[model samples]
Target: MLQRLAFILLAGMLGLAALLVLGIGFDRLSKVRQLDRLPITQLNALNDGIYATSGRVASDAGSLTAPYSQDSVVFVRYLLEEEYTNSKGERKVRTLDSGSSATDFSLVDGTGRAVVSLGLQISQVDWQIRQTHRQQNGSRIYTEHSLRAGDLVEILAHFDRSRQRFELPDRVAGLNAIVSHSSLKIEGGKSLLIAGLWISCATGLLAVGLAALLVGLGIHRYWVFVLVMTLGLMAVLWTIGLVQLKKDWQIAADLYGRRSAAVAAAPANPAALADLYAYYLMIERSASQWPDSLLFRMAAPYSFRVPTLPQDAQNRVRNRLAEVQSSRFAEQNWVLFVVAACWLLTGLLIHFALRAIRFKRLVEFIPTSKTTGLAYGISELFGMIEVDDRYPPLLSSVNQQKCVAYQYRIEEKRGSGKKARWVTLDEGGASTVFWLKDALGRVAVNPAGAKLIFPEKKVSHEGKIRRTESWLPPFRSIYCLGMAGIADAEASRLSLQNSADFGMLITTQTEQEVVRGQGALGFLLTGLALATSLLAGTVWLAGAGSLTPLDLLQVSLLVPLTLALITSILHYNGLVFLKNRVDKTRADIATLLQRRHDLWPQLLVTVQTFLAHEQDLQTALRAVRDGQTGASGQPQNIAGQLAHERQVMARLEAYPTLKGNELVQTFVAQMTRNEDELALIRTGYNNAVELYNNQIEQLPDLILAKSFGFSAAPMWQG
Candidate 1:
């Protein structure tokens, strides 16, 4: 049986790997769907931040010579590959070199041309030149992908005013900065197909492996591994959940305490009453994370309405907020707690099961439509939210960001240390008409009387008070199900409004995510419900003398196994957190690199204006700024520009008059701050890398490290 378990373990690992691949495929599919929704922006009238646009390829600094093809082109990428026979007599190919020309290029649209950087992910290369030849080592293949003067390509990135070029957008930092000739729709379709293939092939293998593993296990020990693993995972999840619940409780208590004090201090003040309402909404939001037990929600506010300020500010259930001191979650009744736990699990089972079925049915049967193709009836939309610029935007209380619709909330805290409890203070929000936009077009969407489904509530804490906010921020992609009607009959324009049957449903989740989450949650809850019942029955039977001590004690080995597994899990989690910290540091470096964008360009212009008389020096700087190289061969990229700035600053300091210039002095001061920021990023990044590397290389952790393939990150010498 043990040997069989070992074999099953190998198969299970393979299945898990296959599942991981499948998950990646689904993720890619989701990303492709989202990418397809972005409307193309005109190059001339570009957005201030990230935008996608298509244009013809051109170059200001003439064409670059393709190393392999020897053809002159505006921009080019080449891949050198060598074919070889593997140990298993299978044909394999390895890339010898994958390099691209390092030069600034131009993307010309109908309106205008924008400067583009070469370090972009060439997703759909034209591959103008392809050659194969027999070499001394092996059969060599050389492919050159060229972007000539007339070739149209799509670029989705932010315009860097400092370097005067476009790099990859920070939002999609996880993906390659894709530059494709194909339309976003076409590209997305291809990506979806590839993802389907990945899921199909992987799923097939996983199914077969699991079948064989199950057969090998036979009758007696059939579900032993599955049972043990499930139980272990459940324990871990429960532990995490308990900790989270405690945190939520503390947050709620903090808000309630403050709200009570505020109400007492200024009971007649309408401002204080509004503040009280905001606190209730936030308290409700926090408590929503807890189980839907009647007792748990006894102290938590049901809901709040922050109507036109000072207009008889009222709450739906005033009792929930008014008597907020007593919380059922704080009570330690063992019997009541047990009963609540069972009831909670049962409720979750029913809720998730129904949701899984209902959501699946609705999505599959209701039919989805683009904003461009809206009819005068039901419409299911997957697009981005666009705030109607005509109206003043609402502000989120926590982040304080501008939004189309928002719920601003604040909770007041009172009491000392562990005895603290929070009360509702104030809550306010706006949900007016907005636009639902897709790649094709945009349509009006009235959020009034709509069922808004926002996932995360932005939360923050300040001395004696807590604030939580939820909002439909501008350009937030969403999946909406609502009734459509002809708003402008003459124009034949449709608008999303409340339906008599379906009402209006808007969520900040993609359709695929919604389906997956619903299905996964339902399945897990069902299993948990069954597991709970089984355990309860077993305990009952044991107490009733239906089972002997030996029968009950048969699984004694689980004790040490559970302990060892728990310890390993803790270590593994620590390592993962460390790795994430390292990743954050790397991301922070990229963010810090852009901090001096506005300053750098201004500084450059100021310095050049200061030295108006030095024609030779001016000419030299222009040449350096362009494609021309100086004595140090000044780099043209942002990093290289920083180095060049250092040299120029030194030259400026050498001249007393130039150094004293007011504009130069201001820029210099700002540049010093920028340098300090860069210094901190460098320090943080390298330190995180060092710590992660050490953790992965250390004793007990290294076992999991190697298993996870945690290779050491390169140290930054900067």
Candidate 2:
């Protein structure tokens, strides 16, 4: 009965937290809507409300030097942190310094320039990292984000015509503010990445956790219950670990926001107070909206580990850690130490598992391209391995089968009876440079830094010895996902290799098979994690005596429900991601459409330069300029732009002289490129809408969508 009551209480807490997270997601979606409604405007032709403008950063005032890198820049913010493992074996990190420097700068587009004052609190700047380095400690590094001269940046900010400066609007606490890169992509609220983690871990772990919960409940063993409770404990600590993980960025942001807020408050302006909060979100929002681990972020850039300060001052700033004390009589909680070890192991497993899941999703998200159609950036290809005939093929050590790549293990039986185990006699693998071939073409593949998971496996027994082998035989179908770049430019062959931008993965298994294999491995690791947690609890319980069913009931109800709520946030976050994608694409389309209107004069002048008839040109221009709103009810007048392009084409055809005219041809080609780009953006917007609608229509997510009144996003009919 006591356990039942605990469940009820924890349920309330879970529900409350869920509601809070849901509220944040909903609020972000609303803000995205507002920003989406606004059009991108040039600085020279500024409007009064929220809009995005792209321009080169320039300022008359002398630039400030970046603290560590010493680069002269208009604005710079940096954070320095040190990380080391503590006596408890827990990862510990401390912030040394973090701050921002800014000055009034002008955003210069060819049309004109607009003054962007640092006078406000909310400098919602997604300052790109200017300089960085790996520290001597090799753990914590500081990043310097800045706005340097000649930076072509897009700023989504409110331009208060009355104030003649860009500032956060007083009406909303959240800025619809997003830099183009903010995918700054304002990426719907908290990053969808977090939502994705919540969803994947929530759904993945919840399913696995419940299965483990069932096994525990069925066994009804006190030790078993202890294991579940132990995991619950680690779950809490894992959160603390994550917090410690993001602390540097968080601290720096907070410090900047607080100091900026204090200064902004002196003027008694609403926008000033609003900006204080906005800067806090810049780092968080600037993250890519993808379903990946938060722990997988790039290490901060370089900063000197040793301070230039005197020894005494340095000692004062960097306090020496307390020495770990030894005591024979002191009672040590073995559970803490044991769980820490298990947690670390579990973390590594989770990281590997998450990578598999990420790759699986990438396979689903990005369509496989023909070899000839591969882009220079991240690409996926389907093909068969074609050996480089110049070199002899790698022969499998076990079976002596001719192969392109192979791994074999030869093991001998050791010991006897209950202690008998397999002792490896020898194990090795070999990879030869090869080509991936499809119907269209083939590309060279370098196997350096690749994680190869082959499909075929064989285990053979001979007396007391056993041999196991897996290999990608020549002509077998293969799936290659990696960074595609130039290998031999003159030969016109592309090379597949690992780069900092994307990971390299080579698999003989099909995409579906690879995904399933990853799922199974993740499940096995999760089960092992449960086993360790249980072992930890059992070890601790050996000294502490027993547990009751009531205890199991009390703890089980609270942890799973909370974990469920935490993880299930994926759908909502996915919705936010989709919404942001749509918004970003919409803004882009609007910019192109506006360019069409802006470029008509150039097109008209080019035509008039050689030909006659001003009346026809003016008439076509007016038709194209008739701004018609799209289905989304935004000011993106796609119809008018379409009419203008159609008119340009029809008018051009009327004159034979304009067909091959150099300037006329250039304008025509530019218009064609614009049309193609606009088509792609429209397609992207529609895709986002479809995903959004599908998410809201799914189970449980549908309930949340209804609660939040998140209706289906309209497709681009424009």
lDDT of each: 0.55, 0.54
Least accurate 10 contiguous residues by lDDT in model 1:
627-636
> Residue-wise lDDT of candidate 2 within 373-444, one digit each (tens)?
664445678898887655356888888887777899999998777668999999999888787889998877
Question: Each model's TM-score, in the order given?
Answer: 0.29, 0.37
On lDDT, the leading prediction is 1
Q: Tell me the spans in candidate 2 whose CA falls farther than 4 Å from its real position.
A: 1-476, 480-506, 529-549, 562-601, 611-616, 622-640, 677-685, 704-711
Over all chains combined, what TM-score does candidate 2 have?
Answer: 0.37
Query: For residues 1-718, could you state the per-residue lDDT of candidate 1 as single tens digits?
Result: 6645764785688567756764665455444423432346566544234445788878687887877767777656678888888765689999889876545578887777788765554432322221322233348877876666677877666555445577653343233455666554455444544544453344334433443354345422213434533454334324433443444344344434543453455335554444445454434533332242332465445322232343335553344444322111222253244445654664565455445544543454345787766654445898887765554466765687777667767899987566578888998777767777899998888777787876547878988788888887778888988766546322235678885545688899877655545544433344344334333332332222222112222222332343354336545765775676567556545554554444555555765677677766555445444532222211123455567667766766776776788877887776676566555445445555676788788877799999988778776552
Candidate 1 matches the true fold with a TM-score of 0.29
The candidate that achieves the highest TM-score relative to the unseen native structure: 2
Cα misplacement distance, residue 106 of candidate 2 (Å): 93
